[model samples]
Target: MADKKPEPATKNPKKANLLDHHSIKHILDETVSEIVSSRGYVEDVRLSNVRLLLGTVIIVIALFAQFYKKKFPENRDFLISCIVLYIVFNGLLQLIIYTKEKNAILFTYPPAGSFTSTGLEVSSKLPRFSDIYTLTIASADPKSISANPPVELTKSVTKWFTKDGVLVEGIFWKDVEALVDEYSKEPKKRK
Candidate 1:
């Protein structure tokens, strides 16, 4: 009788390669979504800054009108009207600022020389995030950049954070990586 050998056992029986392909595709999709979402946060910071500045201007104008009315009591009604209009406009601006501040992400402007928040002085232009942290730490106080840093570096860092992850303040790249790993391990736990 001829010796018979058993057929080799298949390493995977459930079309694991296909499953793996699906898994890889899913991971890629999720990663891209997360990156896009985080970028929106950065954009929010820019918008918030603009809102804050405009709100401040409106408030200042309102205060000035109120003071003017108080000083010139001769034209009481006219002065009062100006004050009232300014107050209403200022109130609207404040409302917008409040909404943006609550919903928007915080961004650090880089250090140029030194600045005081209570004073709200921008020396020249805005700083990039990486340089901002470093310069702010080095400076006696936070300040604006003399000129806007090259956009290339800022864009690169933004892209890097989205793809590889970034260590922002206490938010570390390793921490993000661990979170992603945990989420991937148990998709149900995410919800």
Candidate 2:
């Protein structure tokens, strides 16, 4: 008599490949959705920088305090655990800050989107992207109060126009330009 072997028991009745595909697809969809929905507009750069700096300090202090505590077994274990937790949780905090920076878009549309940022505001009732103009980057004039980048976006428009020339204390002009370019994209098929 031939020995009988039992068939493999599987929790999921579906094909193994299909289960793998489904889980991967679901995870990707959820991740993409979260990223897309997490749009942020950083109206204040200085405040964000300060908060980031504080987080950095906390992390640094946590790591530095370990030197004295490492001599004891229990204390060192506690410190190690705390530091690990801090690092793990800090990723979430950093993501929030990153999203804010990504969304720090000083808009240029109707209702005159102003972010309280020191940058050019189209004060006139002019249409956006109507004028095919050039960007003339003048030398940066830094303010003393700012600890971050002193880059500012001064509109290369004439004084006759309602172009508010501002010295953005913390807003980097490169970051602004990237957002502006993204926002200014025309739809493939206009509604």
Candidate 3:
């Protein structure tokens, strides 16, 4: 009797690759970050800096008054007033910024330098899924508090179903091209 050998198990299965979902999302995020960065859009660091400065100044003054209470009896009232004023000012600033940035285009998505899932969406299906990324780009003017609104552009890109465990399909250069073109255009500044 001739020896019989078992046939090799098939490597390809009908089930969808779940890893593709994460990979696709990651690639999309990286691409979006790169594009936004290329267009010179970056995180608004000045806002954080201003917040830090205000906090430091207020805390130092309060500490100084507390440490010298005996020498300055009036400082207790001064400290109380300072804290109340700071709270009011900080609250107002937060409200204003929040109100301005509450829109879908501004608050949810991360600036160019950060990574976040706010603008990325993945389909629920397992065997087949689509990855869609949406972003709005705008230049942050650090010089003026109320500088004219820089040009704003919203762009979205989608990758269709992943077939046969192979992640090869549409690159969507046209969508990206449109974004690049608009980004290259000179922003309008108010006189």
Candidate 4:
């Protein structure tokens, strides 16, 4: 018999792309943007960028104030003002974000089998300030959408990036690919 060599295992392209921390964030951002836009919401990148910059600056100032407090005890009022400003700024931003059309019902999916549906609700006018994203998926019996009965479903999770943009230790690239694949599937036509 002739000697034969074994074939090397090939990595999935999607999974391979998701392996990097930066790419994972990028893909998730793109996917979420698509998902949100498909439901009729526009992504305000200018607002998003403004929120991110302001939030970052506030945090940096707070940290600097904290460090300064230890070195110069006489300047306690500066640290206090920075902390107060940070809190007040956040409260005002939240008030602005929730000012118009909050918790808008985006889409209602047709029943999977026969009796239930999964609806999506979104904070339609909120400016996204952080890296963390929240998607609300509600499942209820289709006939009783008025009653709004809740159905138990599996918890959704994602590989989170650190404050410094590094991926955390628990989630892997394959896991991310699996999540994206499952959610990206086409829906069945209703009869």
* TM-score, predicted candidate 1 vs. hidden true structure: 0.30
lDDT of 1 by residue, 1-191 (tens): 02222322435321212223333223332333333234221112555566677677777766666666345657677667767777777777677656533322233333224232211111111233221111010111224333222111112223222222321312222333333233223123355
Q: Encode model 4's per-residue lDDT on 24-111: one tens digit a residue.
A: 5454444444444433333334444555776887788778777773556787778788888888878766764575224432333432
Q: What ranges in model 1 sit over 4 Å off?
A: 1-46, 66-70, 98-100, 107-173, 177-191
Q: Estimate TM-scores for all models.
A: 0.30, 0.29, 0.37, 0.33
Q: Give model 2's TM-score versus the native structure.
A: 0.29
Off by over 4 Å in 2: 1-43, 70-72, 103-191
Residues 1-191, candidate 2: write the lDDT tens digits: 02222222324321112223333223222322222122332222454566677688667757765565446665776777667767765776677657533323222112125322233111111124332112221111124221123223333223211223222212223333433334323325567
What lDDT does the true structure give each of the candidates? Answer: 0.34, 0.35, 0.42, 0.43
Note the residue pairs that clash in candidate 2. Answer: 41-103, 42-104
Q: Write model 3 residue lDDT over 1-191, tens digit each, in one string.
A: 02222222335422334446655544444444444444344434454466567667667656765676455565667767767876775775676456534322221233245332122111111122543444444333324333223333332223432454432222433344355445334457699
Task: Report clash pairs, candidate 1.
Answer: none
State how far residue 89 of model 2 sits from its true place (Å). Answer: 4.4
Q: Which ten residues in a row have the lowest lDDT in candidate 2?
A: 132-141
Among these predicted structures, which one has the highest lDDT? 4
Q: Per-prediction RMSD in angstroms?
A: 20.7, 23.6, 15.5, 14.5
- Model 4 TM: 0.33
Top TM-score hit:
3
